[model samples]
Target chain A: MTFLDFAWPSFLAPGRLWLLAVPPLLLAAYIFLARRKSKQGMRYTNTGVLQAVVPPQSQWLRHVTVGLALVSLVALALAWARPFGTDKVPRERATIVIVLDVSYSMEAVDVAPSRLAAAKQAAVDFVNQLPASYNVALVSMSGSSSGRVPPVTDHNIIVRAIEALETQPSTDVGQALEQAMAELDQAPAGEDGDPPPGLVVMLSDAAGTTNPDKSPRQAAKEMGDRGVPIYALVFGTDNGYVDIDDVRYPVPPDFSFFSDLAALTGGQAYAADDASRLADACQKVGSEIGYVEVDKEVTATAAGLGLAFAFVAAVGAVMMGARWR
Target chain B: MAQPAFASPAAAVSSVVTEPSGATIPLSRLAPEAALRRLELTIVRRLEGFLQGDHLGLLPGPGSDSSDARVYNPGQDDVRRMDWAVTARTTIPHVRDTVADRELEVWALLDATPSMNWGTGGVTKRDLGIAAIATVGFLSQQMGDRFGGLIMRPAGLRRLPARSGRTALYGLLRSMLAEPIVPDGTKGPMDLPQGVAQMARSQRRRGLRVVVSDFLTPGDAELDPAHAPAWERSLRRLAVRNQVICVETVDRHEIDFPDVGEILIRDPESDFERYVNTSDEAARLRMNAASAAQRERIRIAIRRSGCGHIQLRTDRDWVQDIARFVLAYRRVAGRLHAPPRGVSR
Candidate 1:
């Protein structure tokens, strides 16, 4: 997401948002009073003497303090409206399938220490952050896809399997999803005979050639139908390249394809062009897939901010009041 | 001439600073009677010799009242003054003579304009002026000398008739202190020059004349030392006949600019107002230069007019300043009060 992007919140008590009108009115009144107090309306025995004596100093600090105070009031008014923002909460139980690309292009050196090694480390970190009760599996994708570790409550086995992965010949992302879906099918049901929620996190360098029988899109759609969402993390810059048969071939991740795949599976897409970004992307994907969305009240935070701003304004006034007089 | 004597510091009491509009302030608050009992204001100009009271005048004269018998000249003396009793006892012609008494009539013209109402140093300029008047009055008033006052406002001038004794002097001071403050922007035909000219035209006989004011003309922005003040000519004319002492009253802040950030400075007697940024050192220097120039111009004008000038500051001790001025004045009074070139003393 770009720096300016924000998730706008919905309010429970929308009618109370009208209280936001108070700050502007107060600002107008302050301006009027400041103008009236500018020495023209006040009486001095001799203005001629004062003209020779007093020089004007910048009152910008005073204005800044007042502005802060006004912002605090706005925050308080927003809290009064009982606004709600989307937040992630830890899931009680879930099954996650990690699909790692072991294609020859994953050996590109654009992401430091090679793309595969960085992706393997990020996947291990991602798995370790999940709840202990969740079942995690690992799948390797190349010319043909196959499961490395079956779905299990203990995530250490999958982390070790990811560390042992090596680059293979061709890349087939559709086959990787099929393999990931087969691993999720093996997840055990709860004592009440209900299957736990399932999520698929895939880290790939690029979208590869697909078979006519199972396209990547068709596989993602089928996974969506089965209540499983795919979170795709792309890890390669456009300048990424690898040498095969003494000839270099560029291997940039197809970000748009992965985004479309994630959309089709009712999930989100993330892109990272470097090792640090790949680590951050892994953490983001882990948090997004491992938690459920819920509404939360943030009134206390707003009120606390309002109180802090008010205290600053009061302290500033006390310190600068002598000069004003 | 004997030097003016000052009372001991222990004998003098501190004066209270009161607002000009405060009518309840006693006369003694400005200048105590005991502090001035020993002090005297020397009158340098030769006054008209007359036996109006027991006080000695600058010049002794012959009077119509009878006195000691003396030998009379045949053509220069009055023949009706022959004393037969003294002639019969000494077998010679004698005449009866009379003693003449000189009474010093002091008229103090107090400027009570709006500018005098300002003071950042506890006492207002108006009250300081009144205090000056009281000091001068107490020093000059004796058994027969009369003390009087003229209050000059923007609209007109009010006069308090000259009267003798200490009680009359107190009454005059009380009247001056009780004068209503002239609100700012009050317009009239009268000003400092006009008021001085009026005092000169009306009080023809003068012994000592004191002009107490801030001497800040409402719209006179001229600061050149060569250019005399608007009232300088009138003061010179008045000095032509009487000894004029110009007591210029000022506040401390008027001369020393304080470093208050930005403030709107305005004139009370005029509509001139401007915003000033005092934080700039250069701006403050410019303002201080202008104020010093203005005060220097006043000093030069007063000197050119040949008047005895003394400046009283609201921040300083007025009594001590007046005392020091009086002591120094004794030496220069003869030179300052010299008659015009065409006239003889």
Candidate 2:
């Protein structure tokens, strides 16, 4: 389901295009007469009485069966159409870092069970779903953020670093992001003189940091300006119930600044509201902007769905027979 | 207290209406004697022009034309009879309108009896009657001949006078339904022949007359030519004059007695009643045979009556059966109406 192979080196299989006709034929049959009563069939006097004695006839169900049959037929046709693709989908040949915010303020149960927990869960999910071809670096932020794993193609290591993150008072998201970018800048570019698209996924509540000189938003904006699209996820309650710093600020800093910073570039910003949405957010960042390769490989050989179509046709015949009986 | 079962409380009081079975059958036209609703009028409209024939009263009376005299067609009848047109259109003999078919005026007849009320099928005998009468009436109207009707019920007959055209057809039909049910059986046994006789005399011209009924009436032993059977002489005499159409209406149970347990039966005639256990297969078979025999009598009566016959049952397809009959009749009439083909010169 990963559309990597088709991105650039898309090989067209002509045979698959021909399979499109079977469904339209079936649709025509569905729309037209199923039975020929006569050239000008006499209109029955009592349609109701005739209906009762006649077998069960479902117009819509037949239409649906015809539709499925056509779909399966097309599938088979495409199979014959000989769909072809590149051997391996192009992968981003570059090192990338993900800085995850794990702070006490992250515990502001604003977004969910707690901002820190949501951030950690998202970072871990993000690491797990990403293509393994790219080297990833992991950095954790608190009152002061630190790099746990430098950018490398070692998914297990990156995953371990993300998992090890825990809530703490150190809330410097800026430091964590800067450290990640520094790690990525040292990596060599691919043969084309262009580094595979570098993606920096930043997970945070954007609710901490006393270092006003370079705020988390400013740090993200600066990093994004230098070619990296900073994918920022802001986890918090818009109602301003989040905790900040060692002292309760009563009002969380409008974390909208971090999202705006990321978006200023052609980057993305996601809101962590649920586990599924958070996972999808990370996956989207990795695929669309990151252009990164995953560890597991996917190869699709479009199988002739003719048999599937035949199965549908059989079901339809059975239904028609039962009604006739 | 239960609205005396027989609508004719007068009859109920007059005689000990020995109900054959305890089942309380309403021995009356159960329909509310209200003004014809706008809907039923439409049912006729839909069925208009189905059956065509000019057999007024549908009985071969003393006045019915039984002569078939026609000239042979020339050049495949394409060039046959041309009187003044022979000298005008072209110097060729072309025959047209030479086929002689005695224009028959079909009188719409309906049987609206209490027994007609029971229906195991989609429609009651009354409903079939409605359709049958409308089919014939519309056909007659379409042919541009005189038409009228007789609507029969257990109560009595309502007579609508013979007239020509669509307005008369509609009026006769509406009036048939409009005739108030005098509730007390005051009008006497549904006069099956009143409408036919009325149309016969009123028109004063011999035409096709269609008599629609279930023919459930018991045969009068004397006048009936056979051992008294169902609808014998009454139908025969009606069919004696004019081109007669015998439309016999029957119901499912009348033909086949389905084992529906002990059903209380009531004879629509005589107000005579008794009990018969339907649970016994033997008894059911016996009753079924008798019904079949009665149907046979009905069939024979219609045949001997010298009339075009059609039978519609409550449990069977009345409309299709009707269409099929009409188509056959039309086929015959079409052959007769076809210009006579020429003999090779």
Candidate 3:
């Protein structure tokens, strides 16, 4: 499998980021359009019987072609804007601890789909895309910093930790980073001379429910001085409002603290208000500070001819399978 | 079909030739003026005979008027081309050249590879190509030549046989009118040196051969002075048998390599393009120098080859240059084999 094409960081301006989800969203919208049209067609009589004989893929093929076209459009758009795999970074390998906020305030609807849900999904996406050799650890950080998964070679455990996360009622942005740094200090000695430089990816809304020692900004700066970068993703805007339990809580989603953290650590700060934007933010973090050489088995065998035979068999099976059905 | 009414058989030689019948008709007897009523009439008239029509390219072209915006000169100019609107607008007198209709047998080695078609100068080199064909046709008609061009059209390389130089021109004109046409089957632009060399080897007689080309092979190490010299040598050798003329066609942007901005220029003939910045004076200078140097060597080669040469620009008055070149060649021709004085001074 030839695994690559044009590569660059795939990012879009916040205003147009919605274009990223245009494909799947449009497909779902088209399905709704079809259902609406079918409903309208049914006013003449019972229409359920007609649906049986009409081939689904024909409709699905139309949908598939539309979806394929839209996907290719996005791929081209991404290609034109430049897209890349995070694993092939220029610098040496580094350690990244994804510190996600799971505090009770994360339950606030200041950000769409709730803050905890966004953070967990974003963190999982980040871990999954990391190269296999990338030393990644997960920290379910809120009232206190607890290393849910320590830096390890395996990726599934970290992804699992991210998926099982729930909203906790407190937060300590400082303690969380400190715990992540401690975990990095203990990673096994590498074959290189210098211990892999450490970095932290802190995804949160930046509202502190607990005043742990050294504010998130202060700790992030101190880490920067130690040659570590903290890329922060602040969830909402300053004018955002949250309604939960029949109480409306206005959020001055203070990302200034997180922005300061990034500036201090010589990293980056991002804003994400939607699921797609969160995915972009995770992608950004991976691109900025991720590089690990995992052994890639690229078998360039002339299987085109062989694959044709298998494809012929598989297609026959499917066709025969359809007859049986 | 009307036949020529001759006072005497000797006077009939001066009669105008008719298309519907190859018969000659006295001028005064023509229906009013010999103007075509409809395109269909002309097409039908042409089909009536052996597709034979009076040669139009033989008529001398109007002198060159290659200007972006031509000014109005009333009695001092061609009053037929007065731009009344411009006169009304600027109050400054201006007159447009009454565009004349003429045809030219245009033979273009249109470079159709991806590069010639891809240019930063809005108009690709290929655009310049067809435009040059049209421009030559437009300009050539000032003298009254019909335009027929040879392009590597959609079908493939179809060489519209060189017939009445004027008839050849009409063929080209028809092709241009068929513009924006995607040639059905085209295995495009040939290699200049190799192609010209082959043509030179096979050509049987002395006739005018005007080559509209940029003469640069794509992706080669910056042009080796030796190659152009060699092409000129072969061309000159060909001149021994034919009246050879090379229209050195080029784009203005190609000449100066103007400091516009950064660009990626792809050579249509060879699918190789490069990111270039014209802002750097040195780079621009080098581009200009290389092009200038190659052309200079070409001039040298052509002069050495014993054939006439002229440069046609997509941006310059190509007709005037062509006219001037033709006039100059006539003068040189008049002098070279001028009957030697008995004293042989």
Question: Each model's DockQ?
Answer: 0.10, 0.00, 0.01
Return whichever of 1 and 3 wins on TM-score. Answer: 1
RMSD of each: 11.0, 24.4, 29.1
Q: Which stretches of candidate 3 lie over 4 Å from their true place?
A: A1-325, B1-156, B165-168, B176-189, B201-203, B222-230, B334-345
Q: Sort the predicted structures by DockQ, highest score first.
A: 1, 3, 2
Q: Give residue A85's error in model 2 in angstroms.
A: 9.3
Q: If you assessed candidate 3 against the hidden native complex, which CAPRI class would it receive?
A: incorrect
Q: Ranking by TM-score, best first?
A: 1, 2, 3
Tens-digit per-residue lDDT, A1-325, candidate 1:
6867877578889999999999999999889877662244223443454443444445776797898889889988988988887666888888899999999999999899999989998898898888899999999988888999989988889888998998888878878899998998899998878878899999997888445246889899999999898898998999999999999998988999999999998998999998899889888887777679878977777788888888888877776565433
Stretches of candidate 2 off by over 4 Å are A1-67, A74-96, A100-134, A138-149, A152-178, A188-197, A207-229, A236-248, A251-255, A264-307, A321-325, B1-202, B205-345
Candidate achieving the largest DockQ: 1
lDDT of 1: 0.79
Best by TM-score: 1
Q: Estimate each model's TM-score.
A: 0.59, 0.41, 0.32
Encode model 3's per-residue lDDT on A198-307: one tens digit a residue: 77888888667666886766777678888887888888656556565688766555677788878988988898877788889889878777653343221212123334
Tens digits of per-residue lDDT, candidate 1, B265-287, equal: 55667776555555567766766
DockQ of 1: 0.10
